[model samples]
Target: MVFRRLLGSMGVGGPQVDTVLAGGAVVPGGTLSGQVCLLGGESAERIEHIGLELLARVEAEHDDGESEGAVVFERFTVGGGFVLGPHEERAVPFSVPVPWETPVTELYGQPLGIVLGVRTELAVAGARDKGDLDPLVVRPLPVQEAVLEALGQLGCGFRSADLEYGHIGGTGQTLPFYQEIELTPAPQYAHAVSEFELTFIASPAGCQVVVEADRRGGLFSSGHDELSRVSLGHADAHTLDWNAEVDGWLRRLTDRPAHQPSLGHQAAPYACAPPVHHDPYGHGAHGHQDPYGHQGHHVDHGHHVGHGHHGHHDPYDRHDGHGSHGSYDSYDPYDKDDDHRSGPGVGTAIAAGAAGLAVGFVGGMVADEIVDEIGDFFDGDDD
Candidate 1:
């Protein structure tokens, strides 16, 4: 996406700035390289500086209520200090480093509904205008991909993904808001958990995969939430069985109770007794549930569906700060639906559990009926 501006802040015939992000999604902690093209308007002007700001349409909740706004989280001075002649043209190239904490906009090239962007700020002749809004598309880190693919293969279906306003208490979270990718439980886990929320904190060393399970109460009990963090080396992703590991992590987390809170760690609590030992789905025996108990079941391989196909009928919240939010275009590379699929399914195999039950992977398109219902829910709220 390219944003061109006639330096709106300046009078008529000012320089125009347009930023073009090289097409293709970048990985977290990867380099995003592109160019800023500037064209001189009616007269000569002094170019002070050309800057780029990384922004997110983040959700903020306060005492007043819940609202959303554009937050400038990072900035860079790409170029400046020059004179523009009448009708002059210049292209300033840039190679900006994406932050390690950048949110994953897509998985296996599918849109997850997270909005991020790059705004080019041009200062010419003492006037500044952040020209054009280019949509930012980010792919998952290798480890993050392995984990999500594993979950989908494990039978979990994608629910909805959103950016939360606050931090998860016990994380090395650098950003104020964290992205939560929520998933409906696979059949195997349904007895123990109602749903699961996954958050990944990636860094140079590795990523901390935090899984939160909404535990369903037993025969006479009420439900609660449980959280567990698993640290994995990025390289180890290629060598381990992520499905088994993830299943084990869920077992350990759901079977345990509360303990003395780690001094600096804050985690959600569940109804079970404190876990005496870690690693429930271990090298040890993997427990099997009876016919009456909730079992985790994953279905077959599914296709990626576009956001438009989700039947979005609700009106966007145009009043929530910039009117731009309502105009966001959902771009899912895997959603092209052209002649070919992308790169052999990311090289991961999904373990579709039990028969007769439907299965949807994390990045797979949700069933048409369920998607329509969700869209209707949002639409109803507007009325």
Candidate 2:
């Protein structure tokens, strides 16, 4: 998307700014290059500086329920400290490093309903405006892709993915929020668990993969959640069979007690959100909490039927904060048409799981407040 907003703060003859991200998808811990194009208004103007901000549509958990908002996670100053001639056009090329913990917005070149954006900030004559808001397409790092592919092979179909605003207690987690990819259990494990959630915390060395499952209680026991952690070298993703490794981890995790659940859903008390800490790199010395910190709770949307199809409705939450009880960002349960998008299926896979249970989402279109946020964003908001 190209934004050419008249510097409203600059008045009628003020210059206009447009930010253009190089065409293509970016990955976590990767560099995003683009141009900040400025067009001189009626006359020459003093340009203080040009800045770029990386923003994510993040979901937060509160006492009552959940809310989604646009959060600026990273910022960079690309150019400025100069003057522009009347009607002169200048393009400032820039390259910025994306945060290592940035959430993935797409899979195999498809939208995951997680929206990220690059907003351009222009400063002139003591006035600043966050101009263009271009949709940021974050593809998974190679390792992340490999892991998900492995899960696909394991018969775990995609359920949903979202960003949470909190910390996982027992890990090298530095970010204030995290991403969770929820999946339906494969047939073999269906009897033991309902679904599982995966999180990836990446650093220069590698990433920490955290897995949690909702284990159905035995005839006499109520359902509970199991948590496990696996560290994989960036290179290990391509070198090993993640299916077997992941399976082994799950088997071992079953022996541990499950995370405490909330009143309505199974909460991953193991990955609770704590105080907020931002990490663009440079890991500070941090303490580990027992995978016992209850980050936040998952919010659920009731039974949903979409696109002429219906399935069991499963509502979940993803909040990310430091463990004042946080969770992952949310996946819009009412997105009726998301399943029709190209690339990987975010909903049910063609192949059924054990007992012919279909995996993935049933699909739906977004509505209500979600529709407003998205529409205003693309339509251009002065804010």
Candidate 3:
């Protein structure tokens, strides 16, 4: 989608900015190429800088309750330092790298109800305005797709997906938040687990698969959550029999004791293949840093906050000054009280077929409604 908006900070007859992302959905850790079209106002204007921000609709847990807001995950200064004459038009092309942990908004071309957008920020004469907001479409990487396909083959159906604000302790999670893909349990495991949530942290070397199972309670026991982690190389997507591999992982997870702290760095119990081990924090493979120098957890508070470089404070930005590191014990992925909840019979089913899981529409909203919601979100209207 192309979003066109006038630089309102410049008052009437100011320049207009339109950002258009290239066709096709982007994958995590891939490059996002787009063009920012600028139309000069009635008078000459000095453009100081043009910035592009990657924003996600994130949910956070607080002492009072849960709240959803827009989080600026990454930003890039694509163009700047130019003077546009009256009525002149210019197009600034940009090719920026997306963060490896960026959330997937779709699977097989179907919306997962995860909202992400690219907003264009224009600065002129000490005034800045985030004038345009366009919806962002991100598809799963090959490894991610293979994992999900395996779950489908095992009879696990997709429920819903969303971005949660917080860090997963003892993992190489770079982003301030992570994506949770909720799925119903396969028939074989239904007696043991009600559902499970999947999280993928992809880096240059490989991807980390984190699975959290909502296990059913016994006659005298209470239900609890169990989490497991495993590291896999990119090539494993094509080499491993994902159905058998994933089933083994789930069996081990459900059978583990509830009191055990996470299955940290453990290899999956796949007998066909030997244990695959890789460093979880191997960022040195590509020498990558947090894309945004700040832990940009600034909340929009149901409105559009100014895109300034400083003076913005977020109570939820719990990082240690550096954008990359943080430990949040408050954000629980298993909490069901959050406004967004997806359970069995609560969302559109991702039907299992001969090939695998077939793509379906979003759970709550259709395609057109999602577009409208995106417009409303950028317009500062939470309702």
Clashes of 2: 44
- Candidate closest to the true structure, highest TM-score: 3
Between the candidate structures 1 and 3, which one is better when assessed by TM-score? Answer: 3
User: Global lDDT for candidate 3?
Assistant: 0.65
Enumerate residue pairs that collide in model 3: none
Order of quality (lDDT): 3, 2, 1
In model 2, which range of ten residues has the least summed lDDT?
A: 297-306
Model 2 TM-score (2 dp): 0.72
> Model 1, range 138-169, lDDT digits (tens) per residue?
87776677677777777787776777655554
How does candidate 2 score on lDDT? 0.61
Q: 1-383 in candidate 2: lDDT tens per residue?
A: 24475656778778888888898877676678889888888889999978877777667876779876665666677889999889888899997666668888666644566767777888888998777667777877656766776677777877777888666655556555688878888787777778888898875556677787777776556776666666665555445666686666655655444434445654445443433333332222222322212232111111111122112211111222211111211211112342222335433241222112211231333323333455465445343
Q: By the lDDT metric, which is better: model 1 or model 3?
A: 3
lDDT of 3 by residue, 150-186 (tens): 7876778787788887666545565667898889897
| Number of the top-ranking candidate, with lDDT as the measure | 3
> Clash number for model 1?
13
C-alpha RMSD of each candidate structure in angstroms: 15.4, 12.0, 13.4
> What's the lDDT for residue 357 in model 3?
24
